[model samples]
Target: MHGLFRFLALSAALMLGFSALASAEPRVRVETTLGSFVIELNPQRAPLTVASFLEYVKAGHYTNTVFHRVIGNFVVQGGGYDTSYVEKPTRSGIPNESGNGLSNRRGTVGLARTGEAHSGTAQFYVNLVDNAALDPQPSRWGYTVFGQVVEGMNVVDDIGAVATGNVGPFDRDAPLQPIIIKRVEVLQ
Candidate 1:
């Protein structure tokens, strides 16, 4: 009886540990007018950034947002603007996690920000190519790379190929027809 009890206890602990490991990383499916792509977040590398992004995803904050900027061979940025070219309200900026060893490679998603290093809010961009210039340097903070496209990368490429021009406040790289993000759903 004593040996059986010990075995059961160990089994229970192992199951619990496995459960925690399974949920440590979360994946999100971004459904756009063009198609869908899956992003697997690296919470271990950028915990705060991943948490902030998941919070927005759970709240359906990405619905109706447009991929306003489509710079081919560069990036496709969105998650802030609406179909009307209006910026949505976002939570306060999070700390930069660019030093976490993730590179700005193709299919990897990075947080969008102004000149300030910690100004990343809800907006993010996927690298269309290996943008080595966006990587972190000793003198400057680079964009935080939190996740990467695990599936449907071709869909991201299709979105990147869309024609862009002046629209509303943006004088360049705005999709001539809005490439709407229908929704972003977190995968189990």
Candidate 2:
């Protein structure tokens, strides 16, 4: 009987420890030409996506990148293009984590991918509105929402308001004046 009680206690303790670690969300401060904003990444909800984003953050992959796509009332995307509009190489795509329970709400950050279901690479976007249409449905995969802006959402709004026009091959939605991502840093 004593051994059984001891085993139960050990199991309970282990579970609590694991739960605490899982709930500890990672955060990053994204510094851009518009302003700086902090994002709290929910690893509990999107583990693989969070890990991949952090890998890029730590490696300085976002520095000097420009928000290549910006649509008012829609999204501001970056993390893969430089000031000269050159696409930066990234690690292979990650599996879609759209079913992680996060939504495409305003201020939420999502991975940018091609039409393929699981093609998220280095690019990401911040939703400017409650974009429910981008949420996952039974028949299709949606963009994965891995984080949300915890501070300076006004900065995101400011970026969304920038004038956009044709820039080379991108004949629409590119910011007329570049919104550069000066740097990105991981926060404790």
Candidate 3:
């Protein structure tokens, strides 16, 4: 009878310990001067994007990056520079995994890209609305969207609502007042 009681107690202790450890895992949080936004990464579809982004997160690459572009009713982009407009050196490009069937819907996060495959570095964008046109197509390349803004869409909205102007010879739309990404955390 004493042995049984001892076994039960040990089992209970182990379960509780595991639960505590799981709960204590650090969740990634991106706190901008504008507001705080949280994201839960998806490693399934956009593995490369997830790996690279998480690598940067672990290394604190996004600590002082700025949201270089903002287009109200469209998208807000960041993870490229500081308030001084100094660009950070990014990791090697990841393959265009936009073939993963995810759409660039509102609140969704996608890697920024140029016209070439494997061109996405650290730059990313948060969808302002359902930008379905950015979705993957069989005939053409698309941006890889590996996660969504699980929390703090209000912060994203706030950034999107900021007034934009051209900077550093950028003729279209950039933030006149550089909005900085103060920090990014990976939530457990």
Candidate 4:
């Protein structure tokens, strides 16, 4: 009787552990003018980046922001500029987590930064193709990919196909008609 009780308790604990692992990932829904998509964030791999992104989402930073940069067959960058081409304020930069084993594959979401490493804050881009060049190398840091679009990738593709040219402060690749981010919400 004692042996059977111990086995039952261990099985129950293992089942609970497996269930926790299954639901460990958090998801967010991004509503854009074109459409909506869901992103599954990999906090286990890029904890800091995911946390920072969630902070921005909860603070309503992405609302009304335009997808300012759209390059066909390349990437669609946004989460910074407003409709009037004004840059929104952001918190301090998060450390680069590019080496966390996530690649810049198509539909993967990555933090967009300048030349400086560890300079990512709020701005993100979705790769339209497998951008192996954006991955980390032996001597250089790469863009951190913390999440991937799991649904409505067609909407992202549509945004990528928009007409782009020099607009406002951008020299080129700015969408002729702004692709606005309507809202971003965390999923329970």
Q: For residues 1-188, write the lDDT of model 2, one tens digit per residue.
A: 99999999999999999998777788899999789999999888889999999999999999999998999999999998999998999999999999988999999999999999899988999999999899999999999999999999999999999999998558999999999999999887
lDDT (0 to 1) per candidate: 0.95, 0.94, 0.85, 0.95
lDDT of 1 by residue, 88-175 (tens): 9999899999999999999999999999999999999999999989999999999999999999999999999999999977999999
lDDT of 3 by residue, 1-188 (tens): 99999999999999999998765423368889998998766776777888888888888889888898899999999997767777789877888888887889999899998888779988889999999888877687878888888889999999999988878645657888878898888765
TM-score order of candidates, top first = 4, 1, 2, 3
Q: List clashing residue pairs in candidate 4.
A: none
Give the Cα-based TM-score of candidate 1 against the true structure. Answer: 0.91
* TM-scores of all predicted structures: 0.91, 0.88, 0.85, 0.91
Question: Which of the two candidates, 3 or 4, achieves a greater TM-score against the reference?
Answer: 4
Off by over 4 Å in 3: 1-27
lDDT of 4: 0.95
- In order of listing, the candidates' clash counts read 0, 0, 8, 0
What value does the lDDT take at residue 182 in candidate 2? 98
Instruction: Please give me the total number of clashing residue pairs in predicted model 2.
Output: 0
| Candidate 2 ranges with C-alpha deviation above 4 Å | 1-22
Tell me the alpha-carbon RMSD of every candidate. 2.3, 4.2, 3.2, 2.4
lDDT leaderboard ranking: 4, 1, 2, 3
